[model samples]
Target: MERTGTMKTSKKMMHCFLWVLALSLIPSAFNGCGGGGGGGTSDAPKQSNNSEITVSSNQINFGSLVANQTADNSFTIQNTGTRNLVIGQISTSGAPFEIVAGSDHCSNRTLLPNQSGTIIVRFTPTANAVYTGSFVIPSNDPDESSLTVNLSGVGQGLNVTINRVDSSVPGNIRMIVSVTDANGDAVANLPNTAFTVFEEGEHKPTIVVSNADVHPVSAVLALDNSGSFWASRLEVQNSAKTFLDQLRNSDEVAVIKFAQVIQLAADFTQLTSAAEINNLKAAIDAPYTDSINATLLFDAVYNSVDRLILRNPNNRLAIIVVTDGQDYDASTLLPGSTHTLDEVIAHAQQAGVFIFTIGLGADMHTAVARRMANETGGEYLYPPTPAGLNAIYTKISQILINQYEITFNTTKLVGTLNNLHVIVDDGTMQGDDAISVTY
Candidate 1:
């Protein structure tokens, strides 16, 4: 009975030990499904998806357009990342450059990953010149927040400025002519065949052409300071000042105020790199006290022409006269008005001076103004009101500020090296180009 009791006690001890072992394994069994087997979450934070943007091209060129004419070009934008891209706005900085929203599919729009949108741009220039600008696309791309595109174009037009004729050696005369596109850019590589020299009803027996773009200009800005002008004196002053600011270095200017009297407001002041443009503008403001009622338009023209002849005998010369009425000095015997319209025209032609006429009001002698400008190979402009004067001045300054002189010695530059200035304006655009040689 003792032996049987010993075996039973041993079996009971074994059963209790097994129970404890099984309990310890229960925790490990739970851990086995979520630990080394790799079936559980990590303690680190999750990563979010990101977006990226790309542009097909960073540059867009319009090539060329006539002044006031427009052209368009397009570029592509794409979302190349894992997430969507949101473009907020499209903007530009500069004149003549703008977005063509009607054809633009990208601005203020959302794009899915791997999707692309197109943006169209337009260029329209108001003047003949080289235009530069840039447009920017603002977006929600993490890598690329904004995309910038550069824009460029040129404007074309035609102009011919002439008759800075120098004849110090009798008939051995050399005349300067500036041939430019409507945008006022110089035309190059033109032969003497481009010009015709007519003296009174006669063509010259000889002609020659050369590049004289560097020849200095002696100009006269004859402004109206009469009673009619009193109504717009401040506007006139500001406009005249703006005109002086446009002149190139080495250009000499003389200001004259015309009314019943022809008074010299400023002497020939040479504008240079060192001189302030305001100094010239101040001269225009200082001379205006108020003007007399009489308009001595012709006498003023005569005086300006005569002064140019006396001062710059062998240089490029011009007389820019702004008047509101006809030559009252021709009709009346005024102290300050002595020269007649016929006398002024004759003297201007003899001196090889160009007379640019600007007619102000309805009382302007249109025939006289036209004659002065046309006869002297200068442009004639009629500004509807005084407010348009600054723009008119700018147009005139563009011509005079850039001129070329082609010399002729009694008839022939035959077989000699000559400059060829090419200018073209088909109304939509204007352009000029040239190459030079000895004349």
Candidate 2:
């Protein structure tokens, strides 16, 4: 029994010795493979001489950003070496562009041995400005100490819009404006109150007031083409040709003819050459036979005021109305109808559209001509004979070249005489001052 007990003790001791040796080998293997000490908790990291870490994309690509647009990007890092890594101080270095959210914007983050993590970068631009920056990524691993990432983008343009409205009662001038930029966006901080209103060919009017934002020129030409004037059509054409010949090429002129119903000889067009002017006149003179309908004479006048004069706020505006005689259909949109002629006339006047009237002989409505001219500080003419057309045209040409533009900040008033005060010559109305108000 004593011998058996001794043998058992020896075997147990041998087993214990083998277990200790095995445990020692396990730690050695772990230390060699992991490089860092194999202890579960080791504050001091083990250093490896033969290991390295590298970042695949050192640059973050953010492509094609527009104004008010945002963008994002990311890159990966790899540990090809036998050591652990702790990334420290990842930062962006550009203006206007800021880091919104992501790991890329972090400072001092840990990365395990032979392990990799992705860093995200984000950008948001405030204005129309281009930007570029880099992320300075610092790491504990000497081989991959610092990783540089590039970021870039562009700024966009401002958007603007312009809208105009006309409100004239019994022949007064009224207008309002709204503006935006090229991107179809409203421009907030614009100095629109300093905007100035000027007529084409005219010096800025002497009406010393506020608002100086400059605008384009607006104009409408209402032509008369009727059977009653068929014999004198050529003469009327000559006068029209002469009048148009003197107009600036920038003028947007529309020609309307009325007999049976109102028709457009031509929509708005710019007069470039004498040939174009002659062509316009010839178009007016072309032979046509349509029984004159009860004329919506005032309706045509009002429509011109609404469509042409009150559409674009960036220009000087005016209307020239031509007619020959009585309305066959007098039961149209006059004072007692859907839209009163007086209202239309008042709107045109208030919108700052100068009104000119051309009457053919005694057969024309003298009252309408007189009312339109008187309301807008314009002139009314009666060409009795066909040959008188050229003379009338000459006068019109002179008037076009001699008129001046005067914008006054009249106390916003109501009713017909709101803007009807006489534009007195303040010694400021000279040859240079006498500019074409109706382009």
Please list the residue runs of candidate 2 whose C-alpha ends up more than 4 Å from where it truly belongs after superposition.
Answer: 1-217, 273-279, 287-290, 330-340, 407-439
Candidate topping lDDT: 1
Instruction: Quote the positional error of residue 6 for candidate 2 in Å.
Output: 99
Model 2 alpha-carbon miss at residue 239, Å: 1.4
Q: Per-residue lDDT of 1-439 in model 2, one digit per residue for the tens?
A: 9999999999999999999999989988878887766667567765575435577675655543334534555567666666556677667786544554555523566655667767656676555555788767777767657767777765444311112223333222333222222222223333323334443323234343322233434556676554565666677666776777666776556677665566677666667776666667666666544555345566667777777744565465666766663444444523322445577667765566656677885577666676776456455666667787777666654444433332333334343222122212112110011111111
Task: Residues 1-439, candidate 1: write the lDDT tens digits.
Answer: 9999999999999999999999888767977866743334455554448777889888888865557656667778998877889998788886799877587798889999899999778898878789999999999987668878888988755555554455455436566666555443446665556555554334554656565546677889888877666788787788877877787777788988877777788888888844556666777887555446677777778888878977756567888887764655333445345766778878887777888788787667666677788677676777788888888888778676556565545443433444434343444444544333223
- Lowest lDDT block of 10, candidate 1: 430-439
Best by TM-score: 1
How many pairs of residues collide in model 2?
Answer: 34
> In model 1, what lDDT does residue 81 have?
77
